[model samples]
Target: MMEADILIENCSEIHTLKGPDRPRRGDEMQDTSKIKNGALAVKGESILAVGSDKEIKRDVEAEKIIDASGKTVIPGFVDPHTHLIYSGSREDELAMKIQGKTYMEILEEGGGILRTVRATRKASKQRLLEESKARMDRMLAHGTTTAEAKSGYGLDKKNEIKCLEVIDELDKSHDLDLIPTYLGAHSLPPEFERSEDYIDYCIEDVLPEIADKDLAEYCDVFCEKGVFDVEESRRLLKKAKQFGLKARVHADEIENIGCSKMAAELDAISAEHLVKTDEEDIIMMAESGTIGILLPGTPFMLMEEKYAPARQMIENGMAIALATDLNPNCWTESMQMVITLACLQMKMTPSEALTAATFNSARALDRPDIGSLEKGKKADFLVLDIPNIDHLPYRFGVNLVEKVYKRGEKV
Candidate 1:
């Protein structure tokens, strides 16, 4: 018999989400690769075997065993986009939006990203770490074991470095695996007069320092109409590549400005908030294999009727992922809530939403280690209180995650 470190047996259902090495697209997203009466063994941090209860019990011996009877197990959610390291709340801005103000209108009035930038810049590293740790704890409780966190709230060189450093510290100390991204081009700081000059400063002064410190794995830019245009975004992302950082973009949230095409041209790992992306750009993104990261929460919070064309993206053979877009503005950390919004607002099926949040989100981060419950993958999964996976989205506004495990250990 093979000796194992841990074993979970008699799970009512297991959505392994296992399939081709690439991200799932079109009809493939609906197929969850489920196992009935499932059981799995973990050896150290990796999954040893996954099969029927009888199959695993007969072949494996473990020091620890968890009887997951009547519970469903699935891969822990991978949230591909979040701005969880910021300081303070935007409830005041929320109130402003309620009184008939647009996001850009508020930004122009000095009350959007810059508002949080001011607070985050003034925050000490310990203060930032503490706040971020609390947010991550909430995310973990909701079954997010891994997430991609960007440092865009700090628009300048000093505070940007500080933000990334805090993210690194959090990653080392917390069980939640936090992937850091440098988003110095999130918006123009008060110091820079022109957007082009700000981009120049990021490429020349900020990015090299981040790269030297190995502070971030990815470099992201906000590629909207008023933020950074297509050409400016392209230049920043190209320079990011030169620093050995993977590129991601916040594109086409409010307008179709050819940013998605820029993402395809630059081969960005993913393009986020495609609520206003054009069909032509969507096709280019699909063909170039750039993952579409849809944030339904953004529109939901902003009170916008239009959401990302997620159903169309799926129909067009695009690999789609879902995220919370968890910032002070959006103010959410629950993947379950995001999944619910994806189903109700974006018209994705329950299975498709789960797949997007788990397997496809992992693909967005270029992480092959934690997306699925399969041999050679990290044993990070959620044991839900429900009997089946669909209940997660069906029973919206509830926390269904009974327990979370990271690398074969309960957390």
Candidate 2:
């Protein structure tokens, strides 16, 4: 046989969360196995073998050898929930939050998601694409290789299609594995301030066109107090599924209104922002196989008291994921900062946090092959300048990623 195309050798540590394994019910969290001083073999765009340096060395002859002598290696981070394509910033809203204004209060003042909706609807696709591309570049530098981007800033039909088209163009033009989600029900558009009219417009007018175009892999609804409620969100997502899109939800970020339970009942791919969900909802999500995407950054940026019950979810056997929730209104697109917040605020172990960012994040997008380092998986991974994997979250407020590889090629 021909030689392997590339070999990465002399790794100080290789943290591999190499399983899509679900633990038996009533057990501790799924455990990941690590290989110390590891080496991995790659051919073309796929991992061929991963083991100790000696083992991998004996197994393959390689045309190109990468000396990862001083670096820690881990699969690239996957951010599975973000609204990175939106226009405008909520800096004014941020200031209001500092003055003790709640998220609901700001939304009531037409200053939260709707503010972004107005700005995005006004901007051209070229502008949105350029801005979103720059944001993705920043995220890539932080070692995010696969990301799920939402089209929530455009709540109407034409603008929703505009946002998804931008996402599609970015995916075609960039190395990042961009998973697109249609979020036409993010909030009530200014034109249709009434909830029922907005819901009708989303389900009857907007979703049909989006579905006909086959532009998105999943459909999402924001099931919150001021946004689409549980019943309305369910109706929208139910209709979205008829168009052959998987379901996802923005649920219970600021209130415990059974959005999580609805997500479970609807069998959503993932439920995001469970800041106000309770133990029963967590169990429901776990039982329903819906990944919990916790966005602590949003709560932090909004200056809110509530955060997702990550520990409770973990203990309850739920697969927990952490994402930037990158958007104009909440978080900026910085996966490193999000990880730090996961550890400090979400109370995840360093290992668990890394797993959440990498493998579980891919799971959040319903993508199995891009998250872990393994044979037959995509050759996407990152090298850290930090001395150890623990430093990724331990050394807070630092840029530890040194290099990123997508499809076996450095970017």
Candidate 3:
């Protein structure tokens, strides 16, 4: 018999999400690879075995045993996109959005990303660490064991490095595993006259420093009309590529503007906020293997009626992923709520949303170890209060995560 460090038995269901090594596309997203009346054993920091409850109990002995008799078990969520290091809140902007101000309108009025940038820049490093650690605690409690955090609120070299440093500290000190991305081209800072000039600054100055420090693994750009346009986004991302950083794009949230197409051309790993993505961009991304990371929270918070054409993307054979887009504008820690929004607003099925939140989101961040429950994978998973998979999205508004485990240890 195999000795186990921990054994969880008699779970009503376990969504292993074991399938293709790559991101799920088309009909592939629907299959969650569920095991009914399931059990799993954890040995150190990896999954030892997963099978039917009786089979696992008969084969393995453990120091600690948990009987999750009526609960669902699933992989801990992997949020591929989040601005988790910012120092301030934007509650006042909620009223502005309600009073009929567009996101760009609020930004042009000096009250969006720039507002948060000012607050973040003014905050001491310790203060920023304190604030960000609190958010990480919230995210962990909400069942996100791993996430991709972006440094966009800090646009300049000094502040950008500070933000990445905070992320590094958080990763070391907090249980939520963070993959940092340098997003200095999120918007045109007030100090720069043109978006092109800001891109130049980020390319010539910030990119090299960040790469040398090994602070961020990915480089992201906001490809929007009133923000950095496609060409500017292209230059920054390409330069980031030259500096050994993988690329991600904030594409077509408010408008198409050829950003998704440009992302396909650049072979960005993922394109986020594809609210306005058309069929051509979808097909191009499918061919280029660039997954569309749909952020339902962003559109829901923006109070916009149009969401990403998820059903169309799925039908057209494009792989899809989901994220919180957890910035000042969206402000959500719950992947559960994001799943609800994906199902109700974007028309993604519950399983598709779950797959997107876990498996595909891992692919978005280029991490393969944390999003599935399988032998040799990292033992990161959630024990939900719910009895079945559908209850994940069905039991909306409240947290269903009864317990969260990271690397074989409960957290």
Candidate 4:
């Protein structure tokens, strides 16, 4: 009964992925099925209908039609964890790491995240916004419709809010939906001599002001060995929840600090970077419905030995997601590059990698409204230049995205 504003016709294959259980049975958790010779009709900002070409054509009249004769149609990739607002690149640190300086050693020498924090604090908000906008343009070109950008590079409250405000302004101006997360608990600023005092200030001072202004939807903390411990992260996230923010944690990236278990117990939306997370934490996360977010690019870039237990998580029936971890520290804003790294290094199938990047990643953000192409869902999808979907990961290290559309309009 709904008339369509646009229709994409004669797609080589349309990947609807319109189901609750993903990693579709019998394929590796990364493989997805397709509907051959498909068509999708959209009205306003939602999918009006989808089916074989004949069926969709019969149901609605389209005001605009796009002939995607040789392309593959897929739901737009959703990236939920990223630190896109920073001042400069870490190429010098990358060079040092390649020269055999360890990540922790670099951090100790004040050359890692702290270095970026200093640079970001000095940069103007307009400059940060300019750099972040460029990165987001690249992400959109690579077929990402929705993404979460964190503000961890700004360790202090003023710079942190400035970074979040950049994200807020981007959402109003850009086509992509940018979700902002406040991460004052990311690290101890130079002014704070004691880590405990830093945690207290983040929880008591900054978080309340952020919540009052409705600046962020989520509050995150780094619950690693040198960062806020599991106990500190717990108290901080617990207090943030009282102020109406959902919880997220940077857990076990460098060591087993019990972040995954705490996130599971608290029913946090997700726990990211579980390279060193224990088997007990794995079981707990699976049982509690907390999504496990993996950052393959971080391990690949850092050449770390510990990889998130992807196969183990899939086998245990835990929902798993993949992210670029797009920060100044490790990863870049290339989601396709992350897909290739996830498939090759983490031993995930191409299909499973796609699912992890799309549907499951949306779940990690505690969102069900986006990520999949179903009737009545948001009309966000990518039209790939490739004919086959399997080529996404198989033919890696190349850009195959031909066109991207969101909200029933070509962006």
Candidate 2 has a TM-score of: 0.95
lDDT of 1 by residue, 287-397 (tens): 999999999999999898999999889988999999999999898889999999999999999999999999999999999887999998999999999888888888998
Write candidate 2's Cα lDDT for 183-207 as tens digits. 8887777787589888888788888
How high is the lDDT of residue 225 in model 1?
A: 82
Scored by lDDT, model 3 comes in at 0.93
Provide the lowest-lDDT 10-residue window in model 1: 101-110
Q: In candidate 3, which residue ranges exceed 4 Å CA deviation?
A: 101-109
Candidate 2: worst 10 consecutive residues by lDDT? 22-31
Give the Cα-based TM-score of candidate 4 against the true structure.
0.95
Which structure is stronger by lDDT: 3 or 4? Answer: 3
Q: Point out the higher-scoring one by lDDT: 1 or 4.
A: 1
RMSD of each: 1.2, 2.0, 1.1, 2.0
lDDT tens digits by residue: candidate 4, 1-411: 558899999999888777755323224354455688999999889988888988888887888999999899999999988988899888888889889998778888878878889999999988988998898998899989999889888877888888888889999999988988988888888899888899888887788889988999999999988778888899999999999999999998888868899999999989998988777888898888888889988888887776888877777777788888998766577778888887777888777888888888887886687888888889999999878777888877778888888887888
Cα-lDDT of candidate 1: 0.93
TM per model? 0.98, 0.95, 0.98, 0.95
lDDT of each: 0.93, 0.84, 0.93, 0.85
Candidate 4: residue 391 Cα off by (Å): 0.4
Stretches of candidate 4 off by over 4 Å are 21-33
Error of 4 at 324 (Å): 0.7
CA deviation > 4 Å runs, candidate 2: 20-30, 101-110
